[model samples]
Target chain A: MNAADLPSSCDLVVIGGGPAGLAAAALAARAGVQTVLFDENAGVGGQIYRGITATPVEDRAILGADYWAGVGLVDEARASGAVIVNGAIVWSLDPARRVGVSIAGKARLIQARQVIVATGSLERPLPIPGWTLPGVMTAGAAQTALKAQGLVPDGRTVMAGAGPLLWLLAAQLLRAGAKIEAILDTAPRMNWLRAAWHLPDFALSPYWSKGLALLREVKAKVPVIRVDRVEAHGRDRFAEVAFGSASGERRMKADLLLLHHGVVPNVNLALAAGVAHRWNGRQLCFEPVVDQDFGTSIPGIAVAGDGAGIAGGTAAAERGRIAAIAAVAALKPDAILPQVQAIRQRLAREEMGRAFLDVLYQPAPGHRRPVGDTIVCRCEEVTARQVRDAADLGCEGPNQMKAFLRCGMGPCQGRLCGLTVTELIAEQRRSNPAEVGYYRLRPPVKPISLAELASLPISDAERKAVER
Target chain B: MFKRLGSTGTEVMLKVDGKPVRARSGDTVAAALLAAGIDHCRTTPVTGAPRAPYCLMGVCFDCLVTIDGVGSRQGCLVPVREGMAVETQLGRREAGR
Candidate 1:
């Protein structure tokens, strides 16, 4: 859909098409309010269920049932009369709920009564040496290629890092008949002890048996090595992976090195839009400060899904529904949202073992806060040493460090390196991440073309002000 | 770096760095480059270092390429099209191109 086809105003506008956005848009539109959802991807399933409708993979079991669950979400949103616009880039959102969206390289401003920012999560930056090499990609990227294009590593593949998604991606790749060199388990041994307190809840949670089965499935096929440190080594593209295990440091020839630690909220848009955010030490990232209804400090705006906080796909959908019901209640005071209470209960159940997972898979400080020549900011190619040196020179925060070294001032707008930079600065300054803070983001959050900006429909008074 | 599992989608013909490449119908430009083993789509503007699609989910700008007459378009976000002309961005895109 183009900007020309979109409504100038809507009762509700969702900033994503993932599980949360789809659920929120569906519930809002079903309550008789006009709803519109804008997604950057070509499809509605977001990252987790990418290519749900257009996947080239024929067999459903190949990508697994959890991925296929996104189809029902897309269907529900479409059937609910919500305007789901794919390939639409939302560049700006003001506290007043005015949204600047660009579609097909054409920009338009849409007024929304209520907005749900469901922009989901992105993989955490793994700042080991040589990570910027061509063949080194996040494990989520591998999953996207597998699900969206039925693509898998055709050469020697080394999977590194710790998280449920790591094992999940490994199982998916194995299912796709891809060869694996070895799995470098980066979950620090100390994490197991720290995470043991949350083990009781994890044992009762739904992910317990599923996580075990996934680990078993992948372990049965490939060698899983518990590694304390890992580094990607290549001149241009990833060719070898060097890792330190209990046995000792080992290096092996590799064609593709898929790295993943965990995922953090993609907070660029939310932060740029002036939503209040706080550093989450447990999650090891900055997340939007939100209320029980997922409402941010900015009124009329709600953040759901992993963007609000990482709680996996099921909880994202439930949170989306709850946010949508809240939106409906706010927009149409008489709107009856009978299932919100039940949805919240389900959401609580979905988030039962999240603490366990967070503590267990929390990336080690050595990996998160790199030293020496390891690159912290891929965009500016800033080394961790440079950032630490700047911090030692009294660089207060990420924003200050950006002026000093341009670490977070790249095209990615700090999505890749924001957490790493913040943590690095904090570690150097002998301060907590909360005290050190994050990048002060502003719009246009995602880069928009000059042509697209020029194409915006100008108001008469605004045009007069600029002309004079 | 990657290969297709199922060869079922309709064939999309495009050129990468002016070389003819065949990709699936649903393939994005990044997927096509990887499927064809054409790593390092663009050299970084800062240091001219070779880079490919690191995230493939649109967060990483490493996959920025020139599609047709346009410059610095995210390869992973743009879908593959027939007769598409993809150029490997050598460095920073020239101003007023």
Candidate 2:
């Protein structure tokens, strides 16, 4: 389990099992390199493409069926000789591509010549008053529950959020026989006009049609409402959700309230490893700056997927393939760059199309600014007013806000509030949110116990080597 | 590409707490459990809210249940194995707590 105990070295070590990691491992193994794929989840595919346990009621369901197909891809990669390790929570990554992994209560070090990072992203929760209530859940979580687990959040549910995921989850809930009270789409009014440019790209596949079909089906089944704001009301658990509509503040009694603002990259590993990143103004994320080959400032290390930025599964898969090809070329110079270039070009086209769609579907500016009493950081119980107060008191950046108000210093490490805090600060400071920038993500993304780190089987020699 | 569901009639049987449950061979434990009308999987320690696989994927811990004496097994991830002893976890009693 120690570094030396590894097979001397592997050609590539992929840090996630989502589309990006799965694609990278499959391509690297196909190229005749020894590869190892590791994921914290027992199953592969990150959050967006979470595996479904049951046979989907409909074959053309966008999220469920497509996600199950990823399992087949994982099997194909394993069949191609890539070592697949599930339920392996990778804690740290050394500069030398040495990964610290905890598998089944055992800690081990995996060394590889090249590393591909595809850790993916997490849901960005808006700190509304009753957001932390028991019945309140993320839209992704709701979809995962119904699609994969075959359990409804409740018999009656209200879906609210601002992304494609919101509509997608709403449709799925309708199919599961859950009486959807209403779907509140918080996407800005301007997005549809802006997103029209990307319609041609979406027409490339029937997948987009399937998503629209789901929406239409949901519209037929339930009332779809477009609201500017939503407020969850309850003493302990969520009892009802109130939305501000043109008519007035309408309240609906519901057992389940699903919210989806958007997603932020899981940047803890990159920050822990000291990778240089810049604030992406458009996507509102801190993404590592990479070259054409996905190589970061740290050579031999590459990043892909939403962890790199907020691109979808298709982009992540392409980026993974590109990183794998680049990693192979690093070890074997004879590998031609033309092949990589062709792949990069195709990926760029797809990425541009997705980016256009994202811009078209971005959340409205008002959702970024919740009511004063709304908690911004549920982990630390910091309210939106506290973040604003901290900003007024010379706390400019999210990191400083964390220091002054402890806003982003929680278990989530600001993945939920980092962008929202930045935007709030920017609004108060009369500057761009990008100017305030992102919070630094420390290592051990998911809190690892001190004992777990100490028990890692990395030998003194390996430790010394890493230190050197 | 495989044809969409509603076309396949592939059937598989796996044990849930030593009882045979009918499921498609590739279906996850959570999927099969749902198809079989087994709702309550585990309980949250703090609130004791009955949590049935919130996120069938491993991201959400709501679906954690004991499978073959292994506590906190993700029902969505683990393929239903023959003779697998599946038990509902009462609360968060792992050592990490």
Candidate 3:
């Protein structure tokens, strides 16, 4: 099929189907723009809102189902005459707002007056010795497995890491009949108390009460420990986890370990399109540098969601709506900016709340650095010692480590090892992890084969756009 | 949300590792497995830590076990089938191994 064979043009093209993308598409279509939303997942909610489809209505109340519930957004967008495209993975974005997408094993190019990139974030993996053990997983991944797939890790489980997500996941596991061996949270004590100040704002809603109730039920049934770090051990698989607690270092034998630190933005498409970006010290990731309009260096192209920065679901959705409005305003300058300004103010408030929550739930500094012998990159089986050795050899950056040891050049595109590598280098350089900067996300983020690119439907216009 | 199966007062029987475990049909596999008191699943390759369903969704791979000899299957996601054979997978095992 040729590019012309597809829809010649649309008013807007939203490149992700998560809360942000869905919100953007819905708002754009509501404004009478011909909009299409595409996503790689079979469903629309993205990772943060994983179980929207499977969770029953009664359970939805406790799960914050309405918060995600992107299906409703999709239906509303479709009602407004927007095109919904599932399982569509966008490969590249040209300078002219032309998007190359892969669907049904075929690639095609779509041209739009404006494009919104709401690609969500990926979990930041903390590499420790034996992290590659079969039983280990990210907290977000665990949520998806249980809520979507109805799968369990084991009968006995240990939930470890920082953030409110740890407590949330632990509660879910308890409901699922898994014996919670321990809830090992690495959040510093001071941070937790400071984070508690925001509790009043959160507690205004009954929803917070229900969440706390569920957590209380779980805590009553299991031991919840605040630890500095976890040292997982097993020859071929994980059998024991050793951690230093207030009492002392304790080792617990368990069948599974769920580890989560936080998330970083997915910036592959933005970087590939040569969009300007800067490092966000707070989230420890590189976010696309955008103006108050959410407009990137590339004209008519906007970004939101975890792709812009790790602001969680509600913030991502708000940012997405803002980006969509800005994109429309770019074409229709006569459009009202009052609504946009209001939404931007709301986003700022949400972002402030998120920042407060993040500081309170941030991982303890000790968790950032594993013992020198621990492996940092599971894909290459690269050890902390190896990375430190490279840093000692004056390997100044993660790029040099990539060149010397191929640490961040794995299948995961460094989502798992990037932050850890940066921290390792910082430790060697006697500097802060923020000063070291995050890894650069290269193009073809999800890894498209050469044949896939060759198969893309191209037109004279799209071909010209690509050439430029 | 409500169903009646056999003499167990409408309880549904799901084959976990080829053994009949009775649970409410609407209950998640993790919940049912936990209710049935079957806890030990696969062990972590590095730490040998005993793991169970941590996140009752697909985000964490901690709940992985073999259903009908298939490895890396999230136990929380795999609904209880009538006669599914679930096994604990250590890692990505080679076909011949």
Candidate 4:
């Protein structure tokens, strides 16, 4: 995308090109409303459907049905006549529906009548000891590489932590012909008892059959260890992973250590835009407060997809359609959206058994709140001890801790460390995560060069306000 | 530690630490680096410890590398271009390049 190709203003601007944004943009455009979608990646598919248009992998069967389902989304979004822009880094979105975006290092501000943020989710950070080593990466990273580049880990690989996605990735990697050494399951066995209450709904849901098949597929090939404690051991790059189970302590030589503990709503952009958010104890992260229509506290802005909450990709698309229908109705008050009810029905079905998955996958307290010498903030290299010590000194919340220890002030802007720091503080204070609160995020949400800001066209009124 | 499962038809060349590395057309700088066996992209600014791309989705800054003439570019976000120059960042950005 070039700077000149950008619009000065638009009817509806959708940020993120995931399942939610794609569905929303396609619906809005098909409804005769002018819509523009911006995605940071070179391709339109968000992480779940990454490389839908440009994947290098020739054998489509290896990626499975769920991964290829994104093709319809990309096709519909492209055919709907929405102005879709790729390689667009949206840095700022204000309460007034003004968006600051950069393309190819050129910046522009566009005023939007209605905005839909469908930024989706990022993998929860697993901050075990030596996790910052070179060979250690999030499980999502491996999936992205495989989906986009047809690359696989050639060396001995050991995946730690537990979630539905972890098993899915293991299955995908094995199908891709990648070698795996072991899978260290960090999910507490007792969670099964707590999650049993929701078993009826889960058994009826679509995930039951697919999850069973996936687990069976991976379990046949890989050594699955139910470990209570796990850590990476390496000097410069990852060389091995160690885990302690009911039997005893054991170690495995590994060239790659993929870590996962489920995903959380990526709330930085929505939070920085002044949307109301609360800590979701069940999901163990902060999520934007949204109503049935997916509308945010800001009148014209809406949040959909995993960014609103951690529903899967299919549910996210339905949420996006609902939000888009609401947007069309708001922009043109007389517009009739007969499909709204149908979309909601689909969403309810898609969201079936989500509670069971959430309860089953909720990370243990120890994993979320690591202690001792384990590094909490990867950017600042601040250890868990330092954060605990700061909390003991009466550091109120993430903001005060940032001022005191510079934990969330790094280049990543608290994306990697905010949840860990909040949990650590909450544990130390014997308070809940909600009371501890999250970092007060500000914009330029994604980093932008100073030169990009300097090149923006300025007006006399703006200049006078600053000059005085 | 990573290998390409197949080719994407066209291949491009990039310089990682002043050495030419062959990369597929659609691969990001980070993916190309990983395939070329360059694990760590940069050392952290605070302690100068080696760090690699943790989250390839642009959330983690561990993939920061010097691209072209600019410093601290997200290698995972930037697609590998033909004859692009990528340097491993040792520490914090040097003053004025």
Residue A278 lDDT, candidate 3, scale 0-100: 80
Q: Looking at candidate 3, what is the lDDT of residue A236?
A: 54
lDDT of 2 by residue, B1-97 (tens): 0112332335777666667777765556775675565655766564465655444444444556777776766676676765667777776646643
DockQ of each: 0.90, 0.14, 0.09, 0.88
Ranking by lDDT: 4, 1, 2, 3
Chain B TM-score against the true chain B, each candidate: 0.95, 0.75, 0.70, 0.95
lDDT of 2 at A265: 74
Winner on DockQ between 1 and 4 is 1
lDDT per residue, candidate 2, A270-370, as tens digits? 77777788877667667888887778988788998778888777778888888888898887766543377677776776665555557766777777776
Docking quality tier of candidate 4?
A: high
Ranking by DockQ: 1, 4, 2, 3
What value does DockQ give for candidate 3?
0.09
- Worst ten in a row by lDDT for model 2 chain A: A52-61
Model 1: residues >4 Å from true position, as ranges? none
Q: For residues A1-468, what per-residue lDDT tens digits would candidate 3 score against the true structure?
A: 223345857789998877888888888777767788887655567776664554432344334544445667656666766788765767788778878887645677777899998887776667656666645666776666555444445556787887657777676666655567888878788886776877666555333655567578778888878887688787656778888867899888887778888777777788777788886766666788987767899988988887888877777888888898887777676654448778887777666556555667676666776657777775455788899899999999988788999887754456567778888899899987667766666566654546667886556997888695
Worst 10 residues of 3 chain A by lDDT: A54-63
On a 0 to 100 scale, what is the lDDT of residue A366 in model 2?
70
lDDT at A247 for candidate 3? 81
* lDDT-superior candidate, 1 or 3: 1
lDDT for residue A285 in candidate 2, whole number 0-100: 65
Q: Pick the winner on lDDT between candidates 2 and 3.
A: 2
Where does model 3 exceed 4 Å of error?
Answer: A1-5, A54-58, A65-71, A192-217, A334-338, A432-435, A458-468, B1-97
